[model samples]
Target: MKICVLNGSPKGNESVTMQYVRFLERANPGHTFTTENIGQRIAAIEAKEEEFKKVIAAIESADAILFATPVYFLLVPAQFKRFIELLFSHNAGSAFFGKYAASITTSIHFFDHTANEYLHAVAEDLGMRWTGSFMAKMDDLLIEMHQEELVRFGQDFLTTAQQHPAIRRTYLPITSTRPDYKSAGIPMPLDCGDKQVLILTDAAPGSNLEKMTMRLASSFGKAASLVPIDDAKMNGGCLGCCRCAFDNTCVYTDGFSEFWKETVLPADIIIFAGTVKDRYLSAEFKQVFDRSFFMGHIPAFAGKQVGFLIEGPVAQCATLQEILRAYPSLQGANLAGVVSDEDGIAMAVDELIDSLAARCLRLSKSGYVAPGGFPAVAGHKIFRDDIWAEMRAFFRADHAYYTKHGLYDFPQSDLRQRLSTTFLSLLLSIPSVRESAQKEMKKHMIEPFEKVFSESPVLKRQKKEG
Candidate 1:
């Protein structure tokens, strides 16, 4: 198989992650692997628009992609994030479909899960088949830098790559699903014919974060413009207090708002790049993120798309989700996509971006359509015929039904328990459940399974599916 190994370390071939790449190459001599360094080079090309054409061509030829980086704050390096933004500019988002992808990260003490999740999400969003993650903590690997573990990681990648088949077996078509739409053709006030995408990243030119951003962008986009954000004066921190409730502006009024107004608002999309600390967004990144909230209630993000490139360990993504869900400025915005370091980040970000992109595209092509009244899931075939059929069986009041389904051991008051299960699942997915209500509901879920199964025929079927 022909594989494209996108090395996202600014250190280039000198990066420790390269050792793993070497191991993979040695273990699977039968497979072909090509490596590229995006790093500061992307930012250089951003200044020369014509060079991007060649970069995009190379990416389209690759069969599978390997996103290898060193974790920074539980996310990909900032430059790699910038590359993604540039890829969007070239409209390379569609090029990722059906391709096999894997993420390998090296971090000293972090879990590298967030980085994996974010990268996987990017792949999934592009309709790619994400195999899995290969994470190695430098500190942990120091104890087992033996040939066996390195060989195992390489073999695992090779085995997984062999399992799933590629959608475009060879040679990607020049045009995407929406051929009329070009990366350079994003909607703008003025017409810019075939104008390559120009993106500025909040990454240092020589850093690992920057390398990851450029590598991803080059792999996925037409041409990229990467400008590093290296202003020491721009560094700041978020004050935990939610003082923006009154004036809708941050009270601490540092240089953060200026960064957004000066750097972010002017672009077609804003890509925030940073690392994670203590399972949360970096102080500097969070400070800017919080300060950007000054556009509150005025619909600053009504049509904007915000993307994030974070580097950290295990919990970076959870922290990112919590921040996004609670951020006021992003209320009406579309979250384009987040590339993290683990499978979970990819899953969550994919769902969020797909939903956001679908709705935004629908609205762009057609006007908003809202039901005259509240909509319910009761009659939806996806929920009723598929989901409810299983739910109903568990809540049925017939003890015989429970026994047939192997749920006879369920406790008393099973009807209430079955009903509560649906609610709990919904609460877990939907973030609106109150702690007090959840606690009270848990107390009422203890019940006999047989009695519950007999009470509802609908629940009986649901139990079977469960």
Candidate 2:
């Protein structure tokens, strides 16, 4: 079997993740392996088109792919991510479909499970079946598994790869429109006169994304507005408290409330412009991202054209899902389109205002919803196998993955039962005569309850695994 390993560390060949690759090669000597240091090659490739062609050829021919990376700030390194961005600029669907892709990530403080899940989700979005995750923590234990785990990974990866058919078959779900005949449906015209557009931005004032933002704005009828993100005193950052759902206003009245009332409410199309900081939205953008909820149930941007302007590599669709989940205020808006890598800060702003205007015009005329539907999860339902896989990963006792996003919340209905059990258990226990025994029991009864109150979302496990 021939394979390609796309290593995603900016450290290049010297990364610890490469050590794992060496182990895998030793474990399975029969399989041919070619490694591409994506981080090291990304910068040099700009002047060398042939290098990308070779990389693309290798990817196309490979029976399986090993995406190995060291977790940087809980995501792929910026440079490595850029290489992936470039892949899309080429033929995105052509190279990746039907390939057996697995992820391997090395991290120090945290296990690589979340990072692997992100990659797996990306593969799923690209219509690729996820084989599985081969994740490890790079601590002292790494030395021990360097031999055995590598062999196990090599065998397992290949075994899974063979199960897939060699002939790639693309499945298109049955559509209302016939396959052979072009739908001669009446074409609709766009109307842009009375439409309004709203622009919301991190106000990086001079960034590449601003250009895309302006283009998006102009499409929406020249509707553009800028909301600066760097003000630290505003809203003290979203506390993840869902209070805004009912209150209809931010609890901390920094500048978010003012921005929403004075600027955000009046626009017909809203353009979200934010720079990428550490592989995620900037801190200022994050604060505004969180505070945007102040729009509440009032239908501020409902039926309005909305688009996102991003400054980094192409964002994973799953990350967008997470964002929607975190903020429900965006439910009714029409998602127009996205623009990335704006070229410069000034360009980003110009693009931001222009894009808002354009999006508003387009929204007024075409009235098209974004390719996918609202609350992205609703558009793409969770599969039975995915739920099962999550349960399986959970049962593996990979606590780091569970800690990051899964276990923090409990279902609301079950909370009463849990609280009852805790109260009853504590009340039923009698005090022991020994002081040490009494102290221990009291601590046990009180500590768990305190922890429960402090953490609103209780840890919840799936009732049934797939």
Candidate 3:
């Protein structure tokens, strides 16, 4: 059987993800494997019709399709994403119809599941029989146990593909009707003062997204500045070289870093407006995200407020919404809310604009941030562990920042808590003590809060005022 390997890594053959593919191919010498560097040659593929035709032809001829990519910014690289966009744009979905599909990704186990979920959705959307996914850590190939796991994955995928099993469709096709959004006169004036507001968009001219961006900017009065991603001069997508890890400097001297630092970083509030394509924002929007990796694992937009103005069927795409929510939260920013075009033209647009303005102002003034959810908590812990262990020397900047910000809040580091827990466990080993502790556990947990309220200066002051 002929297998088409869609290599979605900017590093192409040199990518660590591709190394797994190479291993699979070497292990399964009976099957023929044809590799395409879709991510690396995306520009040429887009420019040359024949180059794209060759890729489609490969897919059309293949019995199975393997998507091998490194998880970038919680998804595939921008270039690979652009290729997926091309598949829809060129009406080439038929090439992948009924083909057996599987995905393999290499990451440090940080949101790798999201990437796999995205690929599964994409493959199913393309009318492929989704086999399964194999997620490997960056160093998994080096371990004997992990190598055996990879071998097992390869055997399973091949056996599944050959058997031609029916796979259930997980994601239903999303039908979107573009709403005709028109400006509802001038927005009500708001005193934005010296606050820096950024309206970042990938909206093309005459699109509803563009109109929404314009309306959002207008709602901010004179404070908001529009920064269309298409206008930004980005040389290319992130190389995933880890060169930026050392000092937070990208290999490419593209003006993106300067623009990001100068225009985006200092913003008090940021409005991201984009049209959803495939399962996510446009590839150009993703390019902006991928390129921003130069900032490394640090929270660049900490304390800022962010809102999303989506011009598509956002409610239907739960994964996209989760990604949107996670992005802001991971950056330590407050997600004001997501406004979608599905809410109708006049009412939704006007209400969202007003709400965004009010929310941004309120959050900025109050400095109230929603506590981190699972993504933020899990992502931070993963980064903290990785940085402190293997990446500490290479990512000195992250280490320094983590040290300075007290991000290394490892539970084991608290000696007092450790000693207290040890003592409590020993005491609880006694049957009598265990019975007493079990009865009083709930009360013990509430004691600290009770003490706070009983001996509180703030409550006393409020009582005196009352």
Best by lDDT: 3
> Which is the better candidate, 2 or 3, if ranked by lDDT?
3
Predicted candidate 3 versus true structure: per-residue lDDT over 87-155, tens digit per residue: 989989899998889999999998888888888888888898888899998989999999999999999
Give each model's clash number.
66, 54, 0
Score residue 260 of candidate 3 by CA lDDT.
88
Candidate 3: where is the Cα deviation over 4 Å? Answer: 456-466
Tens digits of per-residue lDDT for model 1, 344-438: 33335334333433333344333332221211111122222322234344323322333354433324447888888878777767545555556
- Which predicted model would earn the best TM-score? 3
Candidate 1 lands at a TM-score of 0.40
Deviation (Å) of 123 in candidate 3: 1.0
Cα lDDT over the full model 3:
0.90
lDDT of each: 0.52, 0.56, 0.90
Q: Among all windows of ten consecutive residues in candidate 3, which has the lowest summed lDDT?
A: 340-349
Count of backbone collisions in candidate 3 = 0
